[model samples]
Target: MALNSKDTAETLILLLNRSGQGDRAAFAALYQATSAKLFGLALRILHRRDLAEEAIQDVYVKIWHHAPSYRADKAAVMTWMTTITRNRCLDLLRSLPPEHGLNEEQSFDEWASDDLGPLEKATSNSEARALLQCMKQLAPLQRQAIALSYFQGMAHEQLARQLVQPIGTVKTWIRRGLQVLRSCMGAL
Candidate 1:
C-alpha cells in the first residue's frame, strides 16, 4: 500500500481505539472520516436512499457497540468497517419482504445530499469511480432494473409491478446489465 494509505489506516485504527474507550470526539471524527464511503456502499446495496441512510445509521451504532472487539491483526480498519456495513445492509435486506418496492416519487436529491457532496464525490476512490462509470454505460431501463433488484432487494415480480414491465423482461434487463457491468469492471 502507498504511504498515504498506510497513514490513513493508522489514523482509523487510532480513532477506533479511542472510540472503543468511549471517546465521543474520536467517534465523531471516525464517522466524519468514513461515513461518506460507507454510505455509498450502503446505497449501492440498498437502492432506496432512505433505506441506505438507515443502514448507515445502524452500521455506526453497531460500530459504536463493537469497536472494542475490532482486531487490526485480522483486517485493516476500513475493511472491518466495510464488513460491518455490508453485513448490516444484507441483514436489512433479508428482513424486508421481497415484494416491497420503493416509492417512485422519492427524489434522489434528498438521499444524496450528505452522501454525495462535492468533496465526497471528489474524494471517492478510483474503484468506486470506475464502477460508477461502468454503471453509466448500461441502458437506462437496464440500470434501473438492476438497481431496484440489487440495491432495493426487490424481487422480479416487485420490479415488474413498479416498472410496469413483465417479470421476464425485468429479469432479462438485470441479467444483461450485470453482465455488462462485470465485463466493464473486469476490463478496468
Candidate 2:
C-alpha cells in the first residue's frame, strides 16, 4: 500500500529498529527504499554518476554492517543514511587522484551541475540559506578551499594545487573557513 510521509516514517522506524536487531529483510527493505535518494545525494556532491552509484552501494554495505550501531535519536534514519552516503562519497572522492575523469559517457562539466531542483529544496531552507550567507562572508581563498574540499569533492592537496597555494595554507584555509562557518551557522 502507498504510505504518506508519516506512515513511511513509522515504517522506516520499525524497519530500522528490526535491522538494528539483525533482521536482514528489514535492512534490505531499508536499502531498497533509500537507495535512490541516497544516490541522488551522492551524485549531486560527487558529480559523477558511476562514483555516486558506487558510493550508494558502498553506503548500503556499510549500513548493513553497522546497522546495530545506528542511534535513532541522533538523526532520522534518512539523515543518518544520507550522512553515511555523504561520508562514503567524500572518502571515495579523496582517494582518487585529481583530474581522474568520469567515464567517457559523462561530460566533465557536470561537476558544476547540481541536481538543482532537488537541492533547492534543501538549499532554500532557512538553515541552508543562513549557511550560504555565512559562506559568502569568507575570504575568497578560504571560501574556495572550503568549496573545493566540501562541494567539489577535492582533497586538501588537490585544493592546494587548484588554488595555487601551499598544502599548509590550504589546510589552514579549510580549518579557519569551517570555524567561521560553524560560528556563523550557530549564530543563525
- For lDDT, the strongest prediction is 1
List RMSD in Å for every model shown. Answer: 6.4, 5.3
TM-score of 1: 0.59
Q: Relative to the true structure, how large is the alpha-carbon lDDT of every model?
A: 0.75, 0.70
TM-score of each: 0.59, 0.65
Mind giving the per-residue lDDT tens digits that candidate 1 earns over 1-188? 22126688899999998999999899999999999888987876777799999999999999999988888788888888888898889788778886543554532232223233442365446565677677667766666676565555568987788778898988888888889988999998
Residue-wise lDDT of candidate 2 within 44-146, one digit each (tens)?
A: 6677788888888788888877778877677777667777887888888778886763344332222223322333455533555566667666776676566
Residue 55 CA displacement from its true place in model 2, Å: 2.4
Judge candidate 2 against the unseen true structure and give its global Cα lDDT, from 0 to 1: 0.70
> Local error of candidate 1 at 53, Å?
7.4
Model 1 residue 28 CA deviation in Å? 4.0
